[model samples]
Target chain A: MIIKNSIEGSFHLTGGDFTNAGIASSELKSILTELGLDDNVIRRAAIATFEAEMNVIIHAIAGTIYYSIMPEHIKIIVNDMGPGIEDIELAMQEGYSTAPDWVREMGWGAGMGLPNMKKNSDEFKIDSVVGEGTTVEIIINIKQGLR
Target chain B: MNIHEIASKLSLDVKTTKGDLEREVTGCYISDLLSDVMANGKEGDIWITHQTHPNIVAVAILKNLSGVIITNKRVPEEDTLKRAEAEHLTIMTGQAPTFEIAGMLYHFLRC
Candidate 1:
């Protein structure tokens, strides 16, 4: 086993598997939590990562989520090759979702994914070019000396 | 309240395992979205949801929720029930909608 506690990892999310969408984030949460992070910190990291993961499936057909863990910070990157957000401001608004009815029927697509991620993370950045792709980077600060 | 007593109070049916009804609940959260539940629901909380997907069980495990109560007279998929049972998470079905079940749970926990 790779005993890299402060390790960076990446996940390739295949959009076809709605059943397995959040599994990656779930596993990541367990690993971080077991490393003795605070519950609140873990929740923030998990929420940010899971929302990003779900967005790739619900909007884009595929994407990748990458993580970098250090003693004082956790950084995440989500890049998707889906329909790019035309208006970044509009996409960031709460309760403004473009997901179809079917996705809404599954209890997601509430327009809260991005907002939730931003709300939970200490630092958030989004860059998108129309007709190209969207990439989001989130940084969460872990207390100093936390393993 | 114990899960069984809540079931009796709400007149709900045990849709999954009989052994699970006796598990104790510490709190409750009502949400249909798995993400919200995972983000907000505390461990030992009885999750009241209208969803019947296997992902619900996965969320329960991730959040460490005590059990799940499926409201609105909807039965969970067979695989979902089996997964819940395997995880030892209580699963119940209630005739009332999600809101009603939430109200009852709130009163019970408050009392």
Candidate 2:
């Protein structure tokens, strides 16, 4: 189906499933490209999605990633079912990971995921509860009047 | 060195589709963590690591890497290899340890 005006897509992520974490982001990248989004913008959004996807698999037991592609901006939302962040500021730091040993050995938990997401996206916001869950929203503004 | 020469020089076994052998490779990164690989690796680069799993392939796909090399005689999971082939991503196996493979890759790129 041809979507002329805008595009919307969502990817479900299951927690503790390291194997399938990035598939949704990959598919989203392809769809965004087909929708004529900028390459750099697509890359930025994909990076944010990839990190959020990984966090759900590594930290939460389950989560869902929601995204929308517009002519001028791309929006991504990630929601996870797990013990939410205790300190949002500390979590946003570059190297304050709470991942376990195995996850660290896997070359993650360097405490870079959240910072990286913020660095890559043009607009970034986070919401969390100590015992409820976490939701992150990232947006990339597509440069105007560009092919 | 190009992937063709690297494959021939190391006597590595390539498990990639025909199209991948022709893709241009700029450099290589050696890391065991999928997160580090994703954060540091660039497009058109080969990733050398000991961890062999579907997640490695996932990182490669996300980064749009040139290919992947699982070192120290470690072969990727069956499904991982299959997906790599299907995705037209170049993949290879080597008996050298991770550090040794990294050295060889660095030496090759330097010369």
Candidate 3:
């Protein structure tokens, strides 16, 4: 992580690479822990980012997670190249997934990815094009504030 | 109960070092869905799953789980063992079905 006014950096993800799947999110969690952020905030960030990272790995050809941390909050933006969601509403519903059998065999691609991400993050925004890609942005505030 | 004691009683295949063998198991969580575990699993819980991937180790670490039980006699991948060893996380294997072992584990930890 590069530190100036905020701790910010980006991690690149390669699709179908399970060998190093959680490394990026793990590193982020470590940094937040060292910075002495609230434990809840750190956990929420870890879970949200991990779900996003797995999305890129399971579905995208490539993806990148860009994050910035300030004293009050942490922000993450995950962008991926994949067959983007055709219906965001349906995709966000729990127990809805289009992942193939291979992904299912690994104990992933259960329809809970999006719902879990949304459940953990304080602010979540997603946008996608049917044939191009998807982007997810998440922010978790350390201190209580307006939603 | 501690992991080592549990291992002996269950006849589990211990795959990691001894450092955490004496660590107490605080609870139990059984699931194959990674997201469900992430969303609901608690720290110090012993996880039981059919998944033998390294990411299972990652989730164990993320939740500060006591260890992971790979049920159905499925061996963990080499990478998974390496990761767990590096972190000093306990991992064991059992031949029984996931639910059966989970029941045994729940009895050990909760009863």
Candidate 4:
């Protein structure tokens, strides 16, 4: 599916920057709200982007999130450089997490990040290579007249 | 019940006035885990948690929560307060523990 009317933006993320993990999602929420998208769609996009952003902060060395908003859908791609996931299938489990103890102590890393992202997104894709990096792409469809 | 009424009944300290006190409270959710709240919390629900970080505000905004009540007198971080103010999110502090606050909110909302 191709959307004709679209707006795009990108943000650079630094690894271990827990303090600023949600900035991109916050900005995206505002952008979506300003564009008058449905509240449910905005919420889903925000949650998915926030989870992906948290993953980048907790696990990657550095990353960038590229987002595009269209009348029909929103697309977000998060690419990171770090030690990638060894087992993609296992990682999708609800309670599976590799976050360190310190990250868990911060009330995160309950192994819900990827699962929650997938739950909120209409389409979710994750690609990773060990010792190289991981990339996550999510699409949230904005249904018309579904408010 | 509205946020102000609930706060008054529970004797919650109004830490920040960024959010509307008159906003109606539909329900309440108690948790410190951000993802749990995001996944299960309903819009207009007040979130009760012990976590005091900027990300908490982010989560509250995403969930469209009516307000956030921080239990045990734990203050929000400076950055959290700033973000809350910017987002117009209510941040309240209570001297009681999570259990007590949750009970009070439940009783107040029920009434």
Candidate 1: lDDT of B3?
86
Stretches of candidate 1 off by over 4 Å are A1-5, A144-147, B18-23, B35-40
Per-residue accuracy of model 1 over A10-122 as CA lDDT, tens digit each: 99997756777668888889878877877777878887888898888888878999998877788999999888899889999988899898888777888888998999899
Q: All models: lDDT?
A: 0.83, 0.82, 0.89, 0.89
Q: Find the candidate with the highest DockQ and give its number.
A: 3
Error of 3 at A4 (Å): 9.2
Q: Pick the candidate with the highest TM-score.
A: 3
Computed on C-alphas against the true complex, the DockQ of each candidate is 0.53, 0.59, 0.83, 0.73
Candidate with the larger lDDT of 1 and 2: 1
Q: For all the models shown, what interface RMSD does each have?
A: 1.9, 1.6, 0.7, 1.1
Clash list (residue pairs), candidate 1: none
Give a tens-digit lDDT track for model 3, residues A57-122. Answer: 999999999999975678999999999999999999999999999888888899999999999988
- Model 2 compared with the native: what TM-score? 0.91
True lDDT of residue A93, candidate 3:
98
The ten-residue window of minimal lDDT in model 1 chain A covers A1-10
- Model 2 misplaced stretches (Cα beyond 4 Å): A1-4, B16-19
Q: Is model 3 an incorrect, acceptable, medium or high docking prediction?
A: high
DockQ of 2: 0.59
Chain A alone, TM-score per model: 0.92, 0.94, 0.93, 0.94
TM-score of each: 0.87, 0.91, 0.94, 0.93
